[model samples]
Every structure is written in C-alpha cells, then in structure tokens.
Target: MKWQLAGSLGLLLALALVNVQVDVKGYTRSLATRVLGALTSPTSHFTDLETSETSDDEDAEISDTSETENSDTSETESLETSESEDLETSETESSEMSETEVSESGVYNYEGTEPLDLTQKLMDSANKKEEVRNTAGSEYCLSEDDDPYTGFATMTPYRIASTPLKADDVIPAGCKPVQIWHLIRHGSHGAHRNDYIKFEDELPHLRRRIFRARVHWKGQLCEKDLELIKLWKVSKMMSKTGNLSKEGVEEIAGLASRFKSVFPGLLEKKFSIKRHPGDGNKIAFGTGSQNHQSAVAYISRMYDAYARYVPVGSQPSKTLQFYDYCRNYIEGVLNMDKKLKPYHTFMSGGIMNSVLQSVSERLGFPVTVANVRVMYNACRYYYAWYRNKVSPWCTVFTPKQLKVLEYWEDLRVYHDQGHRFEINSKQACVLGKDLMDQFRNRVENGNTELYAASYFVNPEALVTFITLLGLFNDEEPLNEFYVPKTRMWKTSQFAGFGSNLAIMLSSCVDDSFWVSALLNEKPVQLPGCDSSLGCPWNSFIQYYDYLSDCNFDELCGSFSSQLAQSRHWYASYMNEQWM
Candidate 1:
C-alpha cells in the first residue's frame, strides 16, 4: 500500500508541476489548481496541504475577478454612450402619451384663442327648426278671442311661465329652500274609453247630416267649410285613445325643463331626479301608465339623459286613484249621478235644445243634442291636437251657444268631480297627509340629505286635491259656480295638461319654516296667506290635519261593501243634497 501510494503521489506531483489544460466552459483554472496543490504537498503536514489548496482557490478567484471587472468596464462604457438616445426615446414616448391624455380629457385648446359660442349654436339649431315661427300662426279657433279658458279640462299646450324665477324670489331673505314637494298632473291625453265610444257612435251620422246640409245650402256653405266636414274622420281621432299625444309629451318635457331651469340650485348636483335605494332624494309617480310615461319624458328632459333614477311607482290605492278607494267619495260622489239630475235635465231641456237647434241652423243641418255634443268635443280635441290651432268645428257654434255648452260641461264636471259633495274634497286627504309627512320629515331633519320630493298624478286627482286646498278662496263662489252661474273654477287653471302644484319649504329669517304654493307655475296665495310666498308651515299642517289619520285600507273596504249592498246606490245619492 505504501509503494502504490508513493507512485500515485508522484504522478499527481508530475501533473501539478506541469500546466494541465482543462476546458470547463471557460472556468478551467479552479479545479485543476485545487487538484495539483493537493497532490504536490502529499509529504507535507495536512495543515500545510489545506493552506496550499486554499491559496490555489484564492488565486483562481482573483483571475475570475479580473475578467468580470474588465467585462463590467466595457458594459459601463456602452451604457454611457447610449444614455442620450435612451432619454430621447423616453421623451418621445412621454409626449405621445400626454397628447393621448389631452385628447381623452376632451379639453380643446383652440388655435384662435376664442371661446366657442355654445349658446349661439343652440339658438341657430332652434331657429333652423323654426318652432316659434311655426307655432305663431297655429291659433286654435275659439268662440271668443279674449277667453282665457280656451282649453278647459282637455288642457291645450300653453306656456306656464314667461320668465324664470330670480334667485331672491326662490331662496327668499335668510331662508334656504330645503325640500321641494311637487305634484304634477300627467300631460294632455285623448278622451277616455267611454268618450271615444260615444264619438265613434255619433260621428258617422253627424258627417252624413253635414254632407246633406252641404247640398241643401249650396252657395252658403263655403268650399273650406265643406272641406272641413269632409276632413272630419273618426279613425284619426280614435288612434290616440286614452294615451298622451306627441304634443302632450312635448308639453310635459318642456314643463320639466322649465322647472329645472327655474330651480337650478335645488335640482343641480347632490340631488336625484328619481327615487334611489339610499335615503336622499325621492321622486314618485302614480301607477297610471300615462303618469309613468309623463315621468319618463319629464326626467329625460330635466337631466338631458336617459332617466337614471328609477321612479317609485305609488300604489294605485294610495296615490293614483285614491278616490276610488275612498268609501265616502265612491259612495257619495261617483255613484251619485242623480244629484246632477237637475243640471242634466236643464241642459237636455228646451234651453240647451234651442242652442243646439240654432247651431244646426247655422251649419245648415238638422243637428241633435248628441250631434252638438260631439261637435263641441271635436272642437276641443282638434284645438288641443293641433297644438293650439283653432279647429274648423269651433266656427259651427256661435259665442252664445259656446257659453251654454261651457256651462253644461261645467255642471257635469261639478257634479262628478268638483265640490258638489263633501267627499270629493275629502278624497284628497290621503295625498295631502303624504305631502305633509314628507315636509315634516325634511323640516325635522333640516340638515339631512332629503332635498327634493316630487309626486306625479292624474288630472282628476289634481283637480280634487286643489279643490280640497280651498283654491277657489270662497265656498259661496263654489256654490254659485255649481249653480251654472259663473266659471269660478276654470279647468285651465287647475287641471291642465302637465299642470303642477309646487309647495316650497323655505327657511325664514326667524328660523321658522314657511310654505309657498305655486299652481300651474303661477305663484298663488292660500286663504290665510297675505302674499304669494305663502303661509306658515304650522298653518299649512293644520289645514290638512284631518287627513293625517285616514286609513286607506279601511276606507276602501267599507266603500266596497256599501257599493255591493245597495242596488239603487245611484238613485239614493241623487236624492241627497249637495253638501
């Protein structure tokens, strides 16, 4: 073993003395040096061998260090030479990114340095449409040109406010408008099912009679008059049955835009156009389809976008047709067609019959009372549909005949919807209480987020509610108007298409909340109110306290039973005196 070990040691020493070339992916020195050092020092002490091996490893590491340093030096010089090019490329990329950002941000820096006249562009577009000039010559035919109540209950489109409210007019002295409660009636719609049916039944016969009359009075009936009679068609009118006309949609949209413009501070930011999930702003619409459509159009115009806030549709029992659920109203007013018997009898009697005959003679036709009613309806509808243009049918009746017809129409509305019975006004109590509750809640939490509250309803509901509000100013006047004596409660003022009643809650200088009422966009004073700014909040609350406790479900149930039990309910109601 000693001889073999000596021989191996000699071989290793020979290898170590001579330089051995080993290719180890260019790392050739470390392994060869370690082996050579270990073998060449075999006879030396183990500590000496370890020291020699460590020395060899250190020398190999030094050589590697020198190569790495040279490579690093070359890399540093190359990076320094390309630095300016790299910086230029970065700057170009950054400039391109900035331009992209500016384009995305929609900020246009004009070369001319002149601001764009957006308002003038809008005016030019409007002028191109020629809406005002076109509307100028479109005047509705009326018995009297001076008559302000031309539209009556079938509301014609008209301007609500000529000018917008100034800042002082809305905000008032030290008072800030916290909450706005608006009850808007749906826009102008076509006749109901019953009225449409009546028109269909009577129009064909009336048209035939007019044709015969045209032949009877050859020269007296002008070509225009004959053409008007020929143009009268039931199908065109029936197409819009119980739905809002295009003009009606326009009317509602215009009204909403006007309201937004008038109260920008209340409606701008931090306000919701419709009811949202969180408790902030609430806008409600009645369950009626017409009301919903009106709400959509109004919101679209108000926001200048598709309506974002989903509207809360009030229950029909609670808001839309509340009168139908009211026990007293359904039993006493709606079922009581007999109470209006006197007015109906008088209207169908010799006085009105003579007026009808006179109208027929003027038209050179033998016209019945039914035909005359149809003609009057045509006058009203055509006037409204034409967007305030007078219908040719209006020329058929003289001014005196129109007055008689107006009075007869008033009687019908008075008995059915007006103050003929106590229940008519009381039916509005439920809605009144709702308004009061909203106002009270906002007033109690004046610092809270509840800013605007809106309600949409039908025209009939609005009329009844306004009547309950004592809009006529005197009960005696209401009675006199019911007697077919005067036109105190004009339908144009109370229940027109897109009609609105706004109750503004303003904080006063004395730290009290004041309530103001605006009817059809015209400021009006309540009974106790001295000015148009309206009465105290307490008084407003007191005026509607009776309705606060009304149980809608109970009232509806009671009325349903009463209507079921009485076979002669209509007859019984007619006998009862007007309250």
Candidate 2:
C-alpha cells in the first residue's frame, strides 16, 4: 500500500510538470514533447527507489494542482480566440462605416495628376440583343452641342416675398364655385345602412329585402354594381370593409366634421354639405350620393382651411356634378398601382417587358437591337427618375397635360404661401425646373448670394418664408439635359406633392433638421433667414441654428395641434345624427 501511494504521487508530479510546461511553451512541438514525456515516465518503481509514501492528503493536493493548471490553460486559450474574433468583426464594421461616411460626404478626389478614364465595363456586357428603345409618343429637342437640358432659362425661381400676403387673396368669396372635382365610388350592391349590423342575425329576411330593393332598381344600378354595394354594406357593418365602406354613419360624421372645419359658417348659413349635394341629385339615395358625399367632405374641409386666410368679397357660384366627378377621383386612386408597375423590374422588366416587346415587334417597328437598347435606356432612366423623384401617379405635366399641371402648381404655390400645407411646399418648388436651373447657373458662375436672393426680392424674409412654405434649393438639377429651344441643361419635375415633401426635408438643411422638426412630438424652432450667401447655409450646424432661431418649430406645433383636434371629427356622432 505504501509503495502504491508513493508511485501515484510521483506520477501526479510528472503530469503536473508536463501540463505547466505545455502551457508555458504554447507551441505544438513543445506540447507534443511534453505529452510524450508524460506517457513514457516510469511505470515500475520497486527495489531501492528513494520514493516517499505520500499521505492520502498530499496526493490529493498534488492532483488538484494538475487539474487546476490544465483548466486555467484551456480557459485562457478560449478567451484569446474569442477576443480575436471580436476584433476582426469590429474592424470589418468600422471599415464599412468609413466607406459609407465617405460616400455620403460626396467628395471625389483623384490621386493621379492626369484624370483617369473611369467607365463601367460591365454595362457593355448587358444583353445587347434584348435592348429596345421606345420613343414613339415622345419628342426630343436635344441641344446643338449635345448638352442636356438644364431648365435654366425656362425655370427661374420666383421670390416668395415678391407676392404680398393679402388677407383677401387667399379664398375666393362665396366661391361656392365648382372646381372640376373627383370622387371615390361606392360598392356595387348591399343592404340598407341600418340593417348591416344585424345582417348575420337576420340574413334571410335581410336578403329578401335587399333582393326587393335591388330587383326594383336592377336596371338603373346594374347587376354588378348592386351586388358590390350589398357586399360592401355587409362588410362595412361587420367592420371588415376598408375605405369608403358601408359604415356610412361614422364615415359621414367624419365628412361632416371635416366640412365644418373647412367651411366654418357655411354649415349653418346658406349651405350645408348634406343638403347642398342631396337636393335635386338622382344620387340622393344611391351610389351617386356616395360620390357627392366624398366631394363635399373634401371641398368642405379644404375651403374652410382656405377661408381662414383668404377673404374674398363675393361668393363664387358653385356647380355640382355626380357621376363624372366621382369617376375621375376613383380613377386617380386606382391607377396608382398601374402607373408605378412600369417602374418595377418585377412589373416592368418581368411582366410588362414581354408584352411590350411583342407589341412593338408586331407593330412593324420590330424592336431592333439598337431600338431595344434605347428603349431600355429610356425605361431605365424613367424608372430611376420615378424612384428618386415624386409619386408616379400624381399627375405629370407635359404639353397636353400642361394646363392642368400649371393650375395644380399655381394652387400649390398659393396654398404654400398661406402655409396650409407647408410640408408639400418645397416639393412643388423642385417641380419648377426652370427656377432651379437658373439658380444653379448663377451659383456656378460665382453669384451664390445673388442666386439664392434671386428666389425672392427681399432676402431678409428668406428664412421665415422658406420655413412657412417649406421651399428649398434642391429643386434645381445638377446635370444638364436638353430642351428644344435652348442649350443642353438639367431639368426638374418639381411638380408633385411627394417631391414637395422631400425637398422640404432635403439634405441641404442641417442634420435631419427639417424632418426632425416636422416629426418632433414637441414644438421646435423655425429655421432662420440668411443675409449672406456665405453664411454657411449648407452647414449642418449653421442650418440647425437657423432652424432653432426662426420659430418655425412653433408654426409646425400649431399645424400638428390642428391635426390632432381633427381626430375627434373622424369619430361617429351620437348627439347629432344626419338622416
């Protein structure tokens, strides 16, 4: 027993030493040698071996040390590996962040003395045979020197200050005038308003009633229209329907409130939305009525807002229509997807491409390789423009649609001047390509102050005016495209609401200043006006100060406060129900 104890203690000592050696060396070769030494260490120790019989306590203590050393070594190795991995990941993320920051800064510095040729070689390898260009319905007036249109001469910025804010100019008095309008149509057929909630409980009886009402008016309403109205009424009552459903009571109340907000005095005086559209209209109880209701809701709220600022001397004669008016509105909303589909690769490239190609090929202009290429470029350019610009379906302006576009633009400018929709004002400015081009030209020619001041007559009012209207300078183009009468120059669509919103929150301002102000839960300050073009207008810090100093924040606060109060208007009425 004594010999066995002594032998075990010796073995433990050797193992402990080997473990310590391996840990210290930290090399594969050293570890192999130590492991081998441990294995080969004495197996037999008998005659004359000066071994001491260790106590059970001493042997146990030595074994514990051996275990502790190995455990420490393993833990240390694991920590080192984990730390290395973390370092690698951190380095990678840091590199990516640096790249992003550089790109956002928009600084391009070439190291070489002579400018190097930079071209996209991969673009050449695109399916040449599949390329197609369609320019049939379009007219191109390229410049003599092949320069792109800049919209410089045609698009000049008008100073907002030049037009005085006359209290009487905002609204046309009694402008009960009927502007060309549109509406959202109702569902095809359905149960009456009161019977919707009780549909499932008494469907058989309700069906009989609906069958009677629909049958009697079948010819007038059309079968599909009747069926749709029935379904809608049911869905609306069940809270399953989406927009413009059969929840007429609640919807009508919202309409009423919106109207009240817009036409403060009209509801009680000469005209009520409910009575004005209902009298003498065939749609008093039908889909026509639904359409009229929508139009009334829009005009009611809109005009009321308009009247707050403008006071016309005389009320304008208003005309009302039912079917056509409603049809146009519904069509615009429905066509949104139709308009945007052509821009998506999945929609335009995948789905519509085959049809377009086949149609073009069959139409005798068999999309030749060159034509295909041009068409592809045109399509690509159009899609890029759509993605980067404004809403695709929100009316575009060209020669044919120019008048309507102008009216909308003028309305936008007028509305913006009144600060009704400040969020949309800047986007409207961008649509004025003519204004941007001229400003950019002036800036490039070293007249930054004059260029910015050119936007308005009084430079002092620039900040407040911009804040009130949400206008910015980005509406101008950086590159030139060609216009027929002029040299090649860049152009801006500066037409749509979405675009107006974007420029109002453009990056030209301080670090997310406009967006922050517009979206802030609390009221912030407005951006301040700049007297000097060199006042670091583009600097984030400078812009932040301007925004903070101008009290624009308070103005936005007022607007948001109004919107919040309107939420109650959307609720169904209990005190006053309109039959």
Candidate 3:
C-alpha cells in the first residue's frame, strides 16, 4: 500500500514538471519571435530596437539551444539570462540613439557649425604675409604702416562710388531723369580750426621731448622719422585750416564730372541752377566760404556756362542748417557734456594712458592725451592729403586702442548730432518739407522752371536729412541706439568727405513720377517706398507729408522740458543719497 501511494505521487510530480517546462519554453519562444520581428522590421520606428536586440540574439539562441540539449535546469537558467541581457541592450541602444539622432540628419545645419577663432585666423594671416618695410615706398607714397584708425567710421575717406548709376539700365524702361536735387557735403578739406589749434599747442613740446629722448632710444627713432618730425612746420600745415584745400576742390569736381557722365541727358542741357536765395542772385564766392567753394567746384565741372546760379546765404535756408536753430539740439548739447562724462573718464583712464606711453616709447618722446589728440588730427590730414593713403602718425596707436578711440568718437557723434536722440531727426522735418515743396512745384509746373537744385551743406545736416527721409534702410530707431554695440548708421557711408545724396525725379511713360536716391553717387532704394522700378510719386508725397507734420518748435520745447526734468530728478537723487 505504501509503494502504491509513493508511485502515484511521483507520477503526479513528473507531470507537473513537464507542464512547467512546456510553459517556460513557450514563453521564451514568444519573446524570441517578437525580438526577431523587431530586428527585421523595415520602418525607422523599430531600427534602434532591432539593432540592439539582434546583436545578442545569436549568442542567446546558441546558449539556449546548448542548454536545452543538456538539462531543463540549465536551459531555464540560460533563457532567463538571455531575456535580461536583451532588455538591457535595447535600453542602452535607445539612450545612445536619442543623443545621436540630432546629428544624423542628412541636411547641413549651419547652427551646428563651429565658430571661427578670429585670433587664430589673424595669426595665420599675419604669418602668411610677407614682412612689411618700415619706410614709405616712394617720396610721393605714404608709409607702409597700417593705420590703426582705419576702421573708425569717421576716419574713413571717400571711396569711389561702388554702384555707379547706370541711368539707362537702372531707370525704368520708359522713364527719363527730369529734375535732380544734388544735396552734397563739402569735399575733403584741411583740419578743422580746433584740430589745428591743438596741433600747434602740443607739437613744440612733443618735438622737444623727442629730441631729449632720442639718446635713450636706439632703433626706435629712425633717421626718416627724425627728419619728418623736424620738417613738420605747424604754421605752414595749419594755414589751410577750416578752408577747403586743392584736393577738396578736385574731389568735388571729380564727383560732379561723374554725375555728368552718369546722367548726360540731364546735365548736358541748359538747366536752370537754383540755390537757396538768402545770399542774393549772384554766385557769392567768398560769402558762405567752404559751401560756396564746393558749389563753385560742382558748377564749373557740370554746367560751365549753361546754367544760372542763384546765390543763397546760410541765414534764410533753414533747410540746410535746421539743426543750428533747433532748441532741442542746443539743449542736447548742453546736457551732452554730463552724459559724455563717462566716456571722458574712460579716455583719461589707464588704457588710454598705456597707449600714450607706448606711443611715447616708440617715438622717443613723452606723449600726453592732448598730444595724442594732435597726432590723430595730423594723421587724418595727411591721410586725406595723400589721397586715401595711410600716414606714419597713424602708427602711434594699436588697432585695439584705435577701436576704443573710435567708439568714443562714435558715442559723441551719436549723442550730439546723430539719431541717438529723437530730436536730432525731428529737426530734419524742415528739410523734408522743403523737398516736398520742390517736388510738388516740379510736378505741377511740368519740370520747366527748376531743372536742377543743389544744396551744399555740412555732413551733420546731410545725415539728419537722409535719416528723416528714410533713404537708407540699415538704420535702427533712435531709442535703441544705446542698447547695442552694433552701429547700423556709419559715418563713412553717410557723412564721408564729398558725400552726396542725389534724389532724381523721373517721368515714366505712364505719366507717373518715380523717386530714387543716390548715396555717395551709388543708387540706393528708398526705405518706405516699395517698388524696385521706383517709388510712386504719391507714396513719396505721403511719406514727406507725414514727416513734415513734426513741428520743429514743439519738438524743441518738449526736448528742452524733458532735459530740465531729468536734471531736476538727478539733483534730487544726489541730495537724497547724500542725506
């Protein structure tokens, strides 16, 4: 009876074990089938899963088969191990794919491109170039020394207009240039009176120091440099200060001749030359001085005897000197000294002092801030005088130091004269109104009376006018000027010596008037005007009308009041802080 019971229990146990083995084998087969499907799937969805799961599939299968052939315990253990390993491989692959997918895309990604190391590039470029000689190549030639001040916006000289007006090509298929308003700045001139005065005040002391220090310095003071210092006569050099030089005349004449060449039809004819009528009808040669000189230079080149000159004085034409009467600009100037105090502090700091010291060491002299200023003036004059060639004096400062100096100058120009303050542009409304009036007259009178109108003005006035006119699209609003180091308005582009802004009114076959602007003799599109063919006359009129509504007196008063309020607030803050 005991043997029968034991045999029955053993049979039951064997049956249960067989069932368990079958269940385990079924589970393993199911898992393997799913993994194999994932591996073989064509879709990207299963690619990573397949790659990872399939990697160990052969090994897992081989182990499973070997264990299955041996004993049930080993097969079960091996199956469990393979399952765990497969899961871990899938997880690892998923993590790696997540990171790699970003870089796997076929298209080129500029955002992912590495930034260039500018310093390394500069070093490499310097290494590639041949060594530059210390002296000037020829007697008439300028020194080979790189002008550190070359990148300064104001320091840039007039380049030949890159995009010359191909009148036949640029003008619309059926249009003709009828009336041209050539508003230009005086050509390249000698140093300003202030610059000349500074040079005169500092040069003697600088020369004496150079002579004294020459003994201490060995190779620094070359014979050529010594000769240059000795021969530099401040009196003779300064005689042309504030007056246009021969080069200035040539610059204006060349510009005028270029204009004639571009628009032969408009300039070749006997066009009535109209100027602002404050200086009387006769061409006043010596009255307005530099402006008159510029006008004469243009007239002599373009008209000869064909055109009549209407002399205009500086008094009656608010269009040209609109900022002079602007109370807003005057107040801005008054407050500017306070605003610019930080820049002055920066200029007087260790960085500038170091530059001065370095320059002194190089020249075998003691250079002060005042002396540096004089040197920069001399550099500017010689650069222009030699026809866009760099001067030896420009070598006094390094590129980095010159960049700092340029920013300082830029800050002053921006705050005082440029579009940094809103009032600067508002003062240009008078000029805008004048332009509108002239255009209206031409449209109404059928271009018979006024053929060409020229206004010779200062660079600041031209800048203001162009800013208000929305001629260049590259400028940001006045309010945002303080935020960024990126300057869209460049002095070189807008206010360079002999910079001219020409507005040509063309009559198309459709009887529509089109307007386009020529900046420094290059044709430029008007900002607000849409058509590439040319802006519609009506659109131009609307734009001008919108600008003309800015009442000059109201703006001036508002600006003055705001400045006064700011001053009061500042004073109160200071008093409170003290308390």
TM-score top scorer? 1
Tens digit of per-residue lDDT, candidate 3, span 1-579? 999999999999999977865765455445543553343223442233234334633223333445335644553455456445554443344323211111222111224444333223333333332122123212211243443346545545565322455675447778888877777877767676556655665555455445434322211444455555544555445356447777778778888788789888876653334433222112222223567778777777766554344333444244465565565576555345453544455556665677677666666556676677777767666665666544546645555556556655555455556655667677878767666767777786664556577778776687777767754334554231232356565565667677778788888899888887777766666766775445778887766676647677776654355543452332343223211
Taking the tens digit of each residue's C-alpha lDDT, what string does model 2 give over 1-579?
999999999999999977855554344233333333333233333111113213223223333456547755774565445334433443344323211111222221234332211111112211121132223312322111133222211111111001222212222232221110111122111222332333333332222233332221111222232233233212223223222233332233343343344434323233365433222211111123333333343334434443233221132111111111222222322123433321222222332344345424322222332233222222222222222221111111122222222222232232222233333222222223333343333333533222111010111122213433343333332111111232111112222111111111112322221111210011122244332111222442344322323222232222335443432221222112111
**Stretches of model 1 off by over 4 angstroms after superposition:** 1-149, 154-171, 218-223, 270-279, 312-317, 337-342, 473-487, 542-544, 547-579
Model 2 ranges off by over 4 Å: 1-401, 417-492, 495-544, 550-565, 568-579
Candidate 1 lDDT, tens digit per residue, 1-579? 999999999999888644322222122223323332333222333344335434543223333447547755774465444333333433344323211111222222234444333223333433433444234312332333555345344343444322344445545677766678788887766765555666666665555445444332211334444455555556556455547778778877887777777777666654345534324556666655677777777777866643565444544334656765566666556655653545557555777778876766666556676677667877767666676454656666655676666666555556666777666776777777877777877777655567766667876688777877777633553332223445566665566667788878887779798888777777777766667777777887776566576666655546456555664443344334321
What does the lDDT read for residue 485 in candidate 1?
48
> How much lDDT does each candidate structure score?
0.59, 0.27, 0.57
All candidates' TM-scores? 0.65, 0.17, 0.62
The TM-score measured for candidate 2 stands at: 0.17
Worst 10 residues of 3 by lDDT: 99-108
Backbone clashes per model, in order?
7, 65, 1
Please give the distance, in angstroms, between residue 212's alpha carbon in candidate 2 and its true position after superposition: 33
Q: For model 1, what is the error of residue 157's alpha carbon versus the real structure, in angstroms, after optimal superposition? A: 4.0
